[model samples]
Target: MKNKYYLLICLLLSSILGGCDARWDQVLRVKKVQPIEKIDLQGIGAEQMLPVQFPGKSALLIASKNKGVLLLDSNGDHLVSAPGRVETLAIQSLSQGSLLVAAYDELSAEVKLYKLKGGIDRKPVLQYLGGRDEISPQSALCFYQNNDRTHLFTIGDDGLGHEYLVSPGPSTWELVEIRPLYFGEQVNACAVAPFNEKLLFSQPPIGIISMNADAEKDEERKLLMQADQLGEDFGGLWIDHSGNYLWLTADARLQGYELKNLQEGSDQTIYIDSNYYPASVGVIGKNIVVLDEEVDSLLYFEYEPLNPPEHPDLQLVDEFIPRIPASAQTQPVSSAGDAADDPAIWVNRLHPEQSLILGTDKKYGLNIYGLSGQLVQQFAVGRVNNVDISEIQHPTYSAIAAASNRSTPGIDLFAIEKSGKVEYLGLQKLNMKDPYGLCLYYMDSRLSVWVSDKEGELHQLDIHLGQDARNWQLKHVSRLPVEGQVEGCVVDAQNGQLFYGEEDRGIWKLDLHRYSAGMGKPKLVAEVNTKSLVADVEGLALYLHEDSGYLVASSQGNNSYALFSRSGTEFIGNFRVDMNRELGIDASSETDGLAVTGANLGTEFPMGLLVVQDGRNRMPSGRQNFKLVSWQKIENILNLSSATAN
Candidate 1:
């Protein structure tokens, strides 16, 4: 009996430890610490804040909202002031002990550079350097000099960061051609490490991120560390003079982080007054100062690194499960011969919440579903392999829809009613054999359709609406020859560019206008030789923002999605969809087609939605179905440019 009891106790202990591990894997551990409020800034308010020191005295440089920059001592005694109200400010030290201060105004989106001459004993003279440039005034600016050139990096409210180079000749600055790095998080504060050009940016909820200052590639902005979620109480962030620690003010506490293993957890924390929130924080030598608007005082505290006990056996796990992410499975479409092959999202302009998902049932036709995965409409048009949707304004009716008809070698036209139902209009017969994939392009007050086949033949047809809004006619515009079997294709209406994936070789791009006119040559965007992109690059989709975008391709051979710059096809990163145990859906593999939309689609997909055909929906047992992945999850995992992060 005693032996039985011992066995039972061991089992219970094992279960408890397993449960703890499961919970730990779901969320990251955030060490919370409080700092004591020390000194205050008796300035106007915090529009911009910077910490400065000269010769033998330390001062706080406060750029008041509409009052300008005030240089004040530790006790709030005003020493000097620069009269120019600005949105943000950046300071750089010159060789001769002179200071260059650049102030930006949001209302004008202009930056004015000023040179300050002299010391704290006398009121310094401010000289305009004639260095003016346009930038997002709402962003925080940081200046760093490299190779005799001054570069100003801005963290924008849109989460799209930009960098500008100041010319040594005139006072001119030019925007660098670096691909936009989307943080997907509002950067509350930022700092640069002069040692290796490393950048540290802080955001609420997730903590701080360190990326290379000259991050021209996506992999360079790797995740470093995540701090406690301060919610709405997030404050400013600063790196110490030694570049070994990062300081942050959040939840009324001034926190310091040591840089040994940044990807694991924060190193130290100091608590301050709970009643006052630290609006801005800066560190000078061994003293940390904070600005509290509620108390109308500047608080300073002596800083010291705290030594915390280490948990040698404790293992830290990232919130994401490596490259796999959880996803939701749509209701299955029952048809054989690779039935569920492709999908398209149709936004309901009336009730965006009621947006419908249109997927291809290759053996049958098109299947439409509600946001809840309930099949609402199914059109038996005939062996449709791929489907794409675009809004076309007709005189009598509002829009018309089109799909490639693989069974009969033609294109099927339809009209999409506001009620999420598609009405078949007519069919435009094509001379091509075995239509495989199709996409629609609408721009310049015209609509055109592109279709590809198994033999690598591509055709562009300019669709014209006849007198009766229901009648449609296709005008053969151009035909292009490709190397291998082709299927996936998409057009960037904004830039008039065409991108298509050649299953066995790689992805290619060409000018849409010139391609439609049969006058342009195709350029290889990415090839299968790349380790990140396997052979059989199946589906291609474009994620477009107002100023930037990314091209996502389904690397079918590897079961991962590869991203590239939409402008020049620059390689970004790759990710895969994994099983969501709670949702009872399996990981996607051997995907054939995918579609993405930036439009808001209710709560489940407030940011956007990515629908991909899951070749093995349940894996080893169930039928194929489409999977629904929250675009926000992909953004956080890949740090893609997303307004949702903002």
Candidate 2:
């Protein structure tokens, strides 16, 4: 009996160790790793495959170069087959339990679409839809669903992509509004982000590019990953509904990227055979399936959730930074103390040719400049920390600008003329200590100014322009808590929301116009301690559109900017403004203030502009100055659009 018990214990110990070894191999970058499952396709001669998920079941659509398009259930049982030797296969879900399949013919190099008919009980039938003769003969096609309309995307050998909106006709599918996208690379695979509606594509020799689905020009697309990090050859691309991207390389490796921030997260070797070459990849349920044409087999990998790296994967590490051409540079303003802190751009409605930039020389006062960066006017109104402009309905002046007076516990006011000139209107004393950050907002016929102290106390002061326009009435309306040193603040007047940044903490959102004498409780927008945001969140700016908006916060500790959705709790991504070689200006770091707007300021800022305070402008030595960036450049890098929230 003792010998039998010893034998049982040995068997159990061996089983436990073997299980650990299997899991351990999966985590490492080893050459010989066993897949969870594999399906033999040697006899089928499958060239490419795509995963399809319907209301009740999951299946695989295989494109056989020799045969036709074959539909197989998850169990590998053949269900349906459509005539036409295919080189590439793509499947997409349609409204009302319908399905769409796109196939590229191997011999003719023609692209055609078919609608899946029938239910789970019977073999589905493929109804002939439509064909595009204008498409490049040998190309790969993908599908994207935006709102309720479906779009077909194809990348040709010439590196140009064509997008067609699918419109269902009486008996077939119609393609309309063919939009061409010049990716400038021989892209073979493409995927659409389920969360942000961004198009992700791959360029052979390992490059990934992202663009908004509605972008009409090539300049709007940004290369997310270059060929330096990835191997020389790139394969299939897939993005799941959870915003996780899977990419296959010719070297038989699978890479996982986070779609929310466009950061690389996990990597694994697909097959052990040296000759194994991955032709395509797809996500079926929780498994990643890779098609190896060399071995004529499908290798499966279980999806693994990886923790994001300590350092953000997506960062500005290359020298190809988009330069916002500086038409001219302003002559440094001489001050007794440090000057040139923040700037606000105001467009001249009467003379659109004379738009001006209002910059605050901290030690002196406010200095106004023309679009060419030439000094137009300067006011000697004490030391001011921040400045902002707003249109005020006053009898004398139609618009006014305000700045936080750093030398005293007050805020200075100025009248702005349409021709870019400013008149000193004296300072208004506030009931706060050491006012630091300031911004002006108008809503519902009420003009208000928000001022924050160095200790994180935020006070909202209502401004009532006097009849004579020389003096202004200030009413202390509300006070909000920020805990640490708080500085930057901006208001979304359309949403009645207020956002402020705590230097050591993160950002806070509160009810702005509804705040009744500090009665409203502020909600934490993001927390630095959570690692999503770096400590000392410095500047906060809002880029509002017709349907959606973005809240950009300066993550000072990492020298990157964190972008969050204005309507949702999603952290879109983070970006850094690196050195612009073309303009000979260094990157912005330790940013104290930033401002963004969607309104066109001038020809230089036709789309909009982003002005960032460069805390350390290291050309020859460090000097503080505001760097103007075209908002369109930011929109391209981040792949943001009005439909991004959808």
Q: Which candidate tops TM-score?
A: 1
Compute each candidate's TM-score over C-alphas.
Answer: 0.49, 0.49
- Clashing pairs counted in every model: 14, 2
**Which residue segments of model 2 deviate by more than 4 Å?**
1-339, 394-396, 517-519, 529-532, 642-646
Task: Give per-model CA RMSD.
Answer: 19.4, 15.0
**Cα lDDT of model 2 by residue, 144-205, tens digit:** 77445577887777777677766666666666544466665667777777555677887866
- Backbone clash pairs for candidate 2 read 205-232, 503-536
Per-model C-alpha lDDT, please?
Answer: 0.69, 0.68
**Candidate 1, lDDT over the whole model:** 0.69
Residue by residue across 192-239, what tens digits does model 1's lDDT show?
766556677777667666776643212366556555444455647665
Model 1 per-residue lDDT at 253: 58
- Model 2: how large is the Cα RMSD against the reference? 15.0
- Candidate 2 lDDT for residue 86: 75
